[model samples]
Target: MKESNYSSSMTGLELAREYYFQVGRPMLEAQFPEYLPKIAAGLVGDGSECLGFDDEISRDHDFGPSFCLWLTKDDYDAVGEEMQHAYASLPGEFLGFPARNTSARGDGRVGVLEIRQFYGRYIGAEQPPKSLKRWLYLPEDKLAAVTAGAVFEDSLGEFSRIRAALAEYYPEDVRIKKIAARAAGMAQSGQYNYGRCMCRGDTVAASLALNEFVRQAMSMLYLLNRRYAPYYKWMFRGLRDLPILPEVPPLLLRLVRENPLRAENAWKAEKIRNPYLNQADERVELIERICVGVIEELKRQSLTSRNDDFLEAHTYELMERIRDPELHMCHVLEG
Candidate 1:
């Protein structure tokens, strides 16, 4: 039998764009010229493909030759099903890739969609959110997904406009609030509980505290860079791109991956002196060091005034820098 070559080497975003320019756009322009100016075409949603993180391994399921076609409400009502059927009838294979399985409208990531509905599915709002609660309630990952993917073309202009506005980053007050909240979390986990847990010989709990500290610290870095943190799986990958603290990710990985407890074990196994009395003492040292870096960045950004490594003190100090009286008045953990 002739060997079948099935390994897809193209990224999902590239595949979608190829499908759009080669087939989708031409089809729309030739068959429905009137709707061409009113429609938007692109690949976007909750998948790794939307973030350009999709690789060959991502092609096992929803990964395929597909793109979203968004239309104004009136245009959708007029020919939505027809457009959907036409899009569905597109070549089942393109560039050696298979077609995506169709799902009911509003359920699947790609297909004919109303402009408002498409945005709503991701961010819980049909339009760019203007209120603090709306932005605060929407998860950063969702916002990242909404703004990450490539939009092939948006002749209607509505989708791209909303996207542009949202890409501007959080408002000043919102950013301050989020920074305050994450700083508070980092302080609690790294400065306060990590040592106590270690002293109690609760290695597991100490590790958990380290995890929480890293999580909040990473979020704070993204806020400092004025970018939304991507999904948890890509957190470290995303961290390397931060302009303010690109060196932090590797240090963080080391702190988490190298267990001081393991070091103590190796010492006990050899029947030699335990160089460190507390197995977790090294971990605590690393935690404090990370806190020190955060504090330096806070000072550099003029977000805090404290010189010490007490993150909770810095947290309050940073909150005091927010000029918005209402935001300053909100609880430190509000975000």
Candidate 2:
């Protein structure tokens, strides 16, 4: 039979939603009406598609119409295996797309997932971390993954409830702690080390320092906006959407692109009028400008009151703002 004509523009999430409603949902209603309300279905976890960042290139693998059906442990024990079988029996081809070509490690991305097991896999716990220390330690990208994408229907409320709690973002103390760490990292890497590395003619080290600065700065922006930065692969892609530091991305791009390493011959020649030195100077100034913007935001958010241009100075002040005694006492860089 000829394929249907749905636009190729349909994203993975959209395709999953449609596939669930048109195929999965009806299958559940017909064969397991008693279990319908207990299932929480959605496309989430471990995919660019979940974050709505998938494109044509993303279709090369693990890219097709598939959604997760989360069931409570009790319900899963009773019918999980049978439900999985039924789900597997559904149409392989949906809309205009081929069946998912799941890799060896991609088995659990979709299909019947036990609620606690699914959450545990992504978050290290079935429920949101209750302790400030726990919250401080959980990986930000993992948190982003657990909460990304949509929960189509969660009448059981167990899965959605935990997800909603996690989606609220980090506790204020945890955020402050993390922000303080980023501030310290930005200072040590970009403000203090980038120039020094350039002076020593260690262009590779300078580039590494600048890279660390960009990563920390991007993470700080996400913390400031109360969003969890995704995995490193998508960090910059995610940054463009942040409400804070909208201008910082361009500066960061220039910091990486305008490296002294790119002009190595000038440095090797040891010329008095090295254009590469000028480029290095320009990067230092850019680093300060970025730091000033971050400091201003820190002051505006009441994270720090210090007026210092060096971010390390503000790091101490921000760390002191953490109300939790245990978290406050941990290394300022611990977060």
Candidate 3:
């Protein structure tokens, strides 16, 4: 297939949608009209495209005009293979773009897929996990993927139903537990250990501690906003759109980018009292500011009533709000 010189501001998700309507839809309507109403078509699962974060760099591989066609188990068992063949016969190029260069891991990303199999690959279940333990243990990024992308049509409703249930975000008890974990993590890594590592001249350990603090802080922001953070690569992009703690991102960025210790002062514990020490002190103060912002949100949400700058204190208070006996008794960091 030859690539055209065509260029547009279209995102991968938009390209997939247009491809489905212009080519995939017509073929399905002509060849399998009887099953049209039962089929679900959209661009979903396992791609920067699915998350609406794809760009020119995303097109070099596992990209281009493609969308998923999901079918119920019964419909799949009957026509899954046949439908895939029909899908393969669709135009290799659409809107002047070449066909998707599907890598080995991307084979199932496009074309006909069974609904259960499609979800199972992401969340490790045919349906959303029902038990609290299952919900707590499932990875947040996987849950994000399960609910990402646009479902253009789902006449049968099975696929959309699962997506909707997962999209409701975590149950209240589970969310509280997760928030408690993040609070404890931020307290331990940022508030407690960051300055200690800097004082001890362990810059590597100090950097790692700051990274942990940032990770925990980001997760806490998402939980506070009642949204799932996407995979780490797209986290900042996702974070930018979150309604709560909008100021926290810039502080987190400064925490990661600004190195408090100068090269001459690094790994020199005896020189801790130098001018560079003030930079480290500023980062610690910044971390405290973030903690304060989170604490304010926690109070507003009635998740905690603590009046402390230390996040570990609030962690216990948040856990106390958990109504489930089993969950409440579990370790604050279990989630």
Candidate 4:
């Protein structure tokens, strides 16, 4: 009942999945067969396991056997208590591991939680956001967390719909706005700040600038593709999946770790002292090339928005394009 990606000690997701398939799910089937049809399960979400980036460090607290059981409001209200009793009663130990403590009988992100409560914590209402504004404004991690982890049962299919809807790419104007802002930051931090810090003899500051540049550029790539950025640790991992600007992460990382400012400057100094020390011109040329590519990546998105607020307003229109909603609000008003 363990996911292959759960190669480490065992992630919260892995433990949850194990608990669901091995213990919790079987209990439901035998004790409450009728309610089974209204539930759904499995993991496809925001945590480190959902992305396969989890490791030994994930074992501190939330890491353990767990799973989600999603139900519509109608179904949840009817059998929620019965399910809770059954869930709590499931053998608290699996293999050699024991279930951890949660705030409630069932909480997913922390200890273990029922699916409905998990959704309610993030969207401010169980079920998914019904409006584009709700989707735009909702934190990507919250949405990711809700849909993430494994689901052992999903009979009504409501959870799937919400996940699919949330999975959609952002609106064009929103994408443009986010991309523009992030790109501007990347330019300022990576292309501009790194060099400034280096000249001021502040290698630490320069390193910080490179890190910032890497993050902003990664966010820009996610925006360009209309995808949500994952948590910071997996930001580069997330960027690698984009069909657009796929090479950005590797090149950026290379710039950050391999060609750090101190190393590059030292090389330049040696080259200046002796005609044959090293290739100073090459380092300068490479940096300019990186900047040029970054600027061009910003341009290719065709995002014409000027600022973050402008991007925020236009995000929904882009969503309409994605969802092809039955009736567009602005269009109705104009008509």
Candidate 5:
């Protein structure tokens, strides 16, 4: 039998979370049972931990014994201090792990935090949204981030509503705004800009055009799916995980990463003067197809209405559905 090594470089976010799940939760249940029903504990968002991208290298002063606790303002104020004290009292060491102070960044992990503060930092507000204004205010990645990681304990069920509010997805104008933005960018870079850049012998600029095309295409897809695009750096890595366009993600990546000079040759073969130019146009078509595929996936999952104008006005309708406060939450689409 082989002995497995502990993932030493694991995320402080996850470590703080697992600590609570194994040690903190049980300890709290035994000593402070009353608080259990009023709050929730879990992990989600872009913190290296949430995405499972954290490592031993991630353990800096900022890393500490951290987990999220959710409570309404009243409940939070009522028991906040007591809960904080109790949390502090929990054995400082667990499974050979040491707890870190939450204030500023310390040598250890950033300890527990309230859900409101956690979400607010990412999106500038706390609690799930029930209005268009709140919905519109949410940054795309933050919504996706909060919903990305796992929930270890959700006693109060507050996280679900936040997740649910975002679950319905992006709003109508939001989609158009992002799509129009990305489309205009796509037209500028792939449709119009890349060609001109290549013609000028600015291969560097040509490459930038490819990058822009890839970005706009991705924003277009995420908008269509009513999901937020993750951080720009991780967009492609994350985009590959989307089931709707798995087949073409690699292809898109290939086009984006292709040599600008050689790509120019392919475009001449395409008789389009711009190798990357034709590639960009193809992306526009691909974006529409991917959009339609996602809409069909929604239908398959029963996530949308049949009479909702899917074919004629798919993106807008999806955005509209997501915008409706009454319909903020949605179940994951079934295969």
Candidate 6:
């Protein structure tokens, strides 16, 4: 049960895809050739591997060679058990990688899966969400999971086609609503309450405010890029890939690492700040700078027309631009 130190050049997703191609596919072809066209195979869902962010350290637990074989309900009823047994019978190791340890039912990351159930586990629905509320309610991270990872093979085209449509950006109204909500959140947490909390000597509250600001700011960045934010564990890594606001992650890291209250302590030291406090002040400055950058992008995208550092105003402006009458009438900060 000890962790492995072996670091392969390929990512876990790559390893899984290789395993499927070199071994799983051939085994299936020999044993269940007729079933090939009815199944979709890939490495997707619930892991850093699925997002292609796995590193050497990621090979600790629940990390190894594996891929999913997704079948429609009709197909599952016919050959589900046989397919599972066949999948389990593959080599315990592949290309120098160790074999997967069997997980309890409903807990395994790989193997045969019903296509609807596979999607339902992430998106709360077996089918693609068609309603505005359903789309709005699903977490961005969950959406990211459903869409992340590569589908190595899909002879039936059912899975990939649905995935392609889901991968598209939200409707204009949905994007505007989300952007405005996140913008308002940033304004409340960073612009308004952060300073007030600092003035009250409530460093704890100030830290929470900083966290909220960072959280909302990150979401806003993903919305601007029209990309779903991955789970928080890989958010900064995901943020680095955004075409817009790519530099914000490092700035966010600094904010999270330094204490904002340190700036006041530095001012107290005969008005001569120490290097540590200087760094803290610089982080605070970067917060405002990030807001400006986001504002510029919002205006560039024609989502807003406001000209101020206040994010709430930009939120309102964006809300006004929403063409959907019903969405525009809801609370300006409503998601």
Measured over all alpha carbons after superposition, the RMSD of each candidate to the real structure, in angstroms, is: 3.7, 2.8, 2.8, 7.9, 7.5, 3.6
> How much lDDT does each candidate structure score?
0.79, 0.87, 0.86, 0.57, 0.58, 0.80
Best-to-worst ranking by lDDT = 2, 3, 6, 1, 5, 4
Candidate 5's C-alpha runs over 4 A off are 1-17, 53-65, 85-110, 126-137, 261-335
Per-residue lDDT for 1-335 in model 1, tens only?
11126434567788789889999989998888899988888987777788777765554567677899988889999999999989888896787776674444425688899988888877875468867766766789888988888889887799899889889988887887898898889889887887666656677887788889989988988998999888988877778768897767777888878766764454434442333234335565677778788888888888887778777887777777777777778889888
- For 188-270, candidate 4 gives per-residue lDDT tens digits of 67556666666555778877877777677667666767677777777777676688766666677666556554455675555
Worst 10 residues of 1 by lDDT: 271-280
Model 5: how far residue 53 lies from native, Å: 4.1
TM-score versus the correct structure, for each prediction? 0.89, 0.94, 0.93, 0.70, 0.67, 0.91
CA lDDT for candidate 1: 0.79
Weakest lDDT window of 10 consecutive positions for candidate 5 = 326-335
Residue 15's lDDT within candidate 5 is 70
Please state the error at residue 187 of candidate 5 in Å. 2.3
Query: Measured by TM-score, how close is model 1 to the native structure?
Result: 0.89
Q: Write the per-residue lDDT of candidate 2 for residues 84-198, one digit (tens) a residue.
A: 9999999978887888878777778999999999989877863888798988888889999989988899998999999999999999999999999999999999988886788
> Model 1, 162: alpha-carbon shift in Å?
0.6
The candidate scoring highest on lDDT is 2
Residue-by-residue lDDT tens digits, candidate 3, 124-159: 764788788889989899898878888999998999
Candidate 3 Cα errors over 4 Å, as ranges: 1-7, 263-280
lDDT of 4 at 242: 80
**Selected candidate, larger TM-score, 4 vs 6:** 6
lDDT of 6 at 193: 77
